[model samples]
Each structure stands twice: as structure tokens, then as C-alpha cells.
Target: MGLNGFSFYNFPTAIELEYHQPLDKFEKEINEENILYGDKGRAYLKIFFDF
Candidate 1:
């Protein structure tokens, strides 16, 4: 099996986030610590598939 003349075209979009200075440190630590952390915050993304 092989990828024959195949290519990936992704159009992923997300909400551009703005963070407060002090909270940026916490965000970094949370990301480093655990994936389950940062339950209080929210993020956004959208994707579409085409053929």
C-alpha cells in the first residue's frame, strides 16, 4: 500500500485568541502539565473535508 499521487489540502480555521500577560504563564504551565488541565478556558476550531 502506498500514497499514489495523493496530497492533503487542509483549510483549518480558528478563533484568534488574545491572552492576558499574567494568565499566559498559567496557560503555558497548564499545557506542559496535563492535557486534561485548562478546563476553565475554551478554544475554537473548524475544519472541512473535500474530495
Candidate 2:
């Protein structure tokens, strides 16, 4: 899942927001038990300027 939005009318520079979810799964076995790890989701922001 992912989402993205942008705004350019309220600020001097254009702004962008982004969200992402890979929804991935990982497992490991050490003693017959399942272990999950690693990153599950992430987000970021961006700004654009014209000079």
C-alpha cells in the first residue's frame, strides 16, 4: 500500500508527502520457532524550490 499527496498553493514552495508499505514477510528458524525481522514500512517528505 502507498499514498502520495502534493501541495503548492499554501506555501512558497511545492511540498510533497509520501507513504509506502511493502507488506513483506521474512522468517528464520533457530530452534524450530519462527522469527520475523527487517523494516515493514517507511515514509518520506519532499520539497521543491525554484530559484
Candidate 3:
């Protein structure tokens, strides 16, 4: 399940692995570059709406 009752139909192991390791490293690099260049950090969107 995701945020606010949103759920995934099927989650594969690869998705989990990417989140834990490679994606984390990638985010760190991006953040460091932004900081060094005096740029703002990246922002993501998460919507939570139920009908």
C-alpha cells in the first residue's frame, strides 16, 4: 500500500531494490550537486484524494 490508502496492484522485488539502494544513491548525488551549485533541492509531488 502507498500513502493515504493508495495501493499498488502488484509490486515486484525490483521496485523495492531500486528504492533502497540505487535510487537512494542517485538522490544523494542530485542533492549534493544542487547544494554545490547553490540551487534548490528537488521537490516531488504526492497527491492524496479519496472519493
Candidate 4:
């Protein structure tokens, strides 16, 4: 999470990472899914990646 060129902080895990641009009209926007990585069918990978 950062504004400008300054970094705020890194996510504790790679799978937990997300990048969302800020906008006033985005309050109702749904987060797009990454099914290959976020779906439960491949949940084993979470352990493999130490999530």
C-alpha cells in the first residue's frame, strides 16, 4: 500500500498481496477474482507457498 513513490508496507505473504488503486467512485466495485490462485481446488498450493 503506497501513495506516490513511497512504500507503505509489504504483505506478510505473497498470496495475500493485492494492489488496488484508490478512487472515490469505487466503493461498490467488486474485487476481481484470480481463480487459478485463489480458488479452493488448488488450496494445497497455499501450504506449498507457506501461506
**In order, what lDDT does every prediction score?**
0.37, 0.66, 0.32, 0.30
lDDT of 4 by residue, 2-33 (tens): 22222335533333323444343212324774
* Pairs with backbone N, CA or C atoms under 3 Å apart (clashes), candidate 3: none
Could you give me the TM-score of model 2 versus the true structure? 0.47
CA RMSD for every model? 13.4, 5.1, 11.5, 14.3
Error of model 1, residue 10, in angstroms: 11
Error of 1 at 37 (Å): 20
Question: TM-score of each candidate?
Answer: 0.18, 0.47, 0.19, 0.16
List clashing residue pairs in candidate 1: none
lDDT of 4 at 12: 33
Model 2: pairs clashing at backbone N, Cα or C within 3 Å? none
> Where in model 3 is the C-alpha error above 4 Å?
1-40
Model 4 alpha-carbon drift over 4 Å, by segment = 1-14, 24-51
Q: Candidate 1, which segments miss by more than 4 Å at Cα?
A: 1-41
Better of 2 and 4 by TM-score: 2
Q: Is candidate 3 or candidate 4 better by lDDT?
A: 3
> What is the C-alpha lDDT profile of model 2 across 10-50, one tens digit per residue?
56565566777766777889799988765576687877765
Model 3, 1-51: lDDT tens digits are: 222334445532122111111223222356457323323344334543332
